[model samples]
Target: MASHLDLEEQEQLEQVKAFWKRWGNLITWVLTAALAAYAGWQGWNWYQRDQAAKAGAMYDEFQRAATAQDADKAAAAAGDLKARYPGTGYAAQAGLEVARLQLDKGKADEARQSLAWVAEQGSEPAYRDLARLRLAGLQLDAKAYDDAAKTLDAVKSPEFAGLVADRRGDALLLQGKHDAAKAEYQKALAAIDKTQDYRRIVEAKLATLGVPTVVEAAPNAGAVQ
Candidate 1:
């Protein structure tokens, strides 16, 4: 019985050896690939953390220069953020700050350029939308009515929908299209939340355009109370 059991064990060992011989290379390759991928994923996470830290430091430098009103220093830091961390929110925010500084210095064209960069290449949707809105405002002030319209057309976020319509109304009014402007302002008024103060501004605009804003009636107290 011991000899029979030994023979069975030998046969089982031979079968395992044959199976390994057929599949060992593939298994080794798969494990090597998996380990390499895991290592790469870990390295990528480390690289992103390092990049964010560096970008945040540079953004701090920009804030300091901006607070000091040192235009040149602020511009330098903003440019650096743009060049090295274009994928970061810091770059877009720095660009916005630079645009504000430029506008404050009466450099309208320079401000437009900075805002255009942010509008086109910002890393966040809200930043891009804000840049576009500001750029459109600048364009409107410059009497580039058509350009302002074109810029407003690019604003797609629902959060900015009312503001975009309002700006479009301003552009139309500037072009002497009173009826079109009134329609746009009406749309703005409807899109804006009633509880917010901005709707008052829109309502005032509609009033100027000969559209009487309907005062909302009070909600019935029994309903949903």
Candidate 2:
């Protein structure tokens, strides 16, 4: 009986060895690949966290410089953040600050460049829209008529519809298209909340074009509550 049991155990062990021989390399390779992928995923997470932390600190510095009205310092810090962390949201925000400061400093061309980059390449859609709006306004002021219209045309926010129309009206007025301007002004009025006090400004714009006020001083026309 002992010899028989020994023979059975030997056979089982040989069978196990044969299975390993057939599948060992494949199993080992699969395990290696899985472990490597997990390590890579963990490394990627750590890298992103580190980048965000650094970018956030730099952005705080940029904000402080902006608050102090140190335009040059703000621009320089923001530029550094943007160059080093262009993939971060903070970088896009810094671009906005730098653009505004440049504009305030009468650096129109530089402002346009910064604003255009933010508008076209910002990481967030909302920030991109805001940049486009501001850029459109600047271009309008510079009489870059076609460019302003094109930028404004790209804005698709429902909330910005009224403002865009109002700006378009301004652009048209500058181009001596009073009739078209009036139409756009009317659209702006229609887009705005009738109860918003700002609607009065739109009304005034329409009045300037000799269009009969459709929403005079109705108490409800400018009340929110």
Q: Write the per-residue lDDT of candidate 2 for residues 16-86, one digit (tens) a residue.
A: 99999999999999999999999999999999999999999999999999988888899899889878988
For 1-225, candidate 1 gives per-residue lDDT tens digits of: 999999999999999999999999999999999999999999999998999999999999999999998877888899999999998999999999999998998889989999999999999989999999999999999999888888888888998999999999999899999999998898888888888899989988888777789766687945775
Task: List the global CA lDDT of all models.
Answer: 0.93, 0.89
Candidate 1: misplaced stretches above 4 Å? Answer: 214-225
The model with the greatest TM-score is 1
- For residue 152, give model 1's deviation from the true position in Å: 2.1
| Model 2: residue 19 alpha-carbon error in angstroms | 6.8
| Residue pairs clashing, model 2 | none
Error of 2 at 222 (Å): 18
